[model samples]
Target: MKIAVFFVGEVRDAGFNASALAGADVATAEGLAEISIISGVRYDQDAIRARLAEVVPEVDGLVFIGGQGNITTPEIAAQYPGKKFAIVQGQKTGPNLASYDVLQEDSAFLAGALAARLTQSGTVGHLSGHRVPPGLKGRAAFVAGARQANPDIQVLTGFCGTQDDRTVTKAWAAAEISAGADIIFTMLNDARSGAIEACREGRARQIGNAMDWVEVDPEVFIASAIARIDLGVKGAIKDMVAGIIPDTPVHLGLAQGDFASLSMGGDVLDVHKEYIAKIAQDIRNGTCTVPNTYDGPEFQP
Candidate 1:
């Protein structure tokens, strides 16, 4: 299969692409496919549709990573047929498109739960990047999970409204830490480095999003909320190989071994190993539900 990856802006900095790209690489390793990248996707729907129109005909499979996010309406896919589209972290649905919706709240909740347990000050902080529905869902779930662990646990939440301004994000983290938030979930996208730095300097712990961060800073990072975008990519590719391009969006979450999980590397994790396992099972079995998004203010300790 000759597949082209649709990158929203620069291919180098797209956080959602890492796992999908890894999936494509895995298919390439199996000698089943070749990968090509397409970039410069504008946020506008018309522009994105046009861009896809220009690129779709050339590739056997079209994978749009973070292209206009979700398609609760399916007009775009109908306009482009024959070519299969694998959308990672998107909510678009259509016969020609296989969209992957990674329910990050599951892992986010786990992160919140863990954070609740870790804090001696009864306070934890959450820092967010750009506002997207899924991102909002993850943030809300973090608070919910923390509260689940400790009803009295204080959650200090804030949004930078931008993903790359490290200085600004660092300030946000600093403020939260100063307020006695010992652990903060830095969902500040690319600006997370600054928040992590702040957490380290303040002697406050930090949580990772998507990929593991322990190797990056073991002393500061207690754990990472593992969002399995990789599974979405790999699964979509296998579907492509099977000769069927799903029109509906595929939901990936804890139930399918794609649970946004916390890494088992930390000593604290070992302590909560049983709890984590039980919770994972509950989430997988549909006994426990994590809200993807919630509406609220910046909660304080």
Candidate 2:
């Protein structure tokens, strides 16, 4: 079956779009489904909607990656009865729309613990594109995880003002590094490449989100928190193909290989795997509850 995904940025995207594309490609290769991706640069909601409107007829289903507010709203989906809809990072308003969600707090907790255990500088930082839900929740979980490992470790935060601006993002990372944050978890979408560059220049290790960036730069990007949008997309497509798509939102977590997880690369600190695994287990079992937001200081560049 053929599927279409409406992404809010260019094809060379870094965070969510890239991961979803990667997942879609893999799904096609594995014979699960075929996917066509369409992008409209951020904020051109009208143009994006027009593109999707044009592309929808050619595919069996349409997946909107972060387009709930732009491409199609609950009202819009309600108007398209026969069109199968799956949304990555969207709200569930009614039947025929499947919303894919990532349980980021679990993986962010893992990342925080990893950062605190490895940082030579006693301070860890989070770089983001906005002070929004998943990013904020991830950063907050990171802080909780870090403190759970080392109670006194300081956490730094910064925002790049936009998801696609690398210059601003890179500068933010540099400033965070100058403040002695040796490990940074970047959730800045396409701007993450900038943070990775900054980490390399500062000789600090980095953690990425939404993809298996364990080897993005073996030296600087030593860890990644996976938000597996690809898996979510693939699963949603499979359900659509099978005519069993769920109308309510689908939440993927540690138990679901598709949702989120923190992976340690070979280049990172040689912390015992069991230590990290235990934290993950606690999160999965509800033994460790990760707070969903951090009311910490956030700098905008």
Best by lDDT: 2
Q: Candidate 1, overall lDDT?
A: 0.75
- Residues 8-119, model 2: lDDT tens digits: 7665576777887887788788887777777764546576667766777787777777633323545456767777778776656356677777677678888888988888
Residue-pair clash count for candidate 1: 5
The reply for model 2, stretches above 4 Å from the true place, is: 30-34, 57-60, 67-71, 267-272
TM-score of each: 0.87, 0.88
Q: How does model 2 score by TM-score?
A: 0.88
lDDT of 1 by residue, 178-227 (tens): 99899998764567778878987999999887777776678888888878
Worst 10 residues of 2 by lDDT: 67-76
Off by over 4 Å in 1: 9-15, 39-54, 71-76, 299-301
Q: Model 1 clash pairs? A: 94-247, 95-247, 137-292, 137-293, 254-259
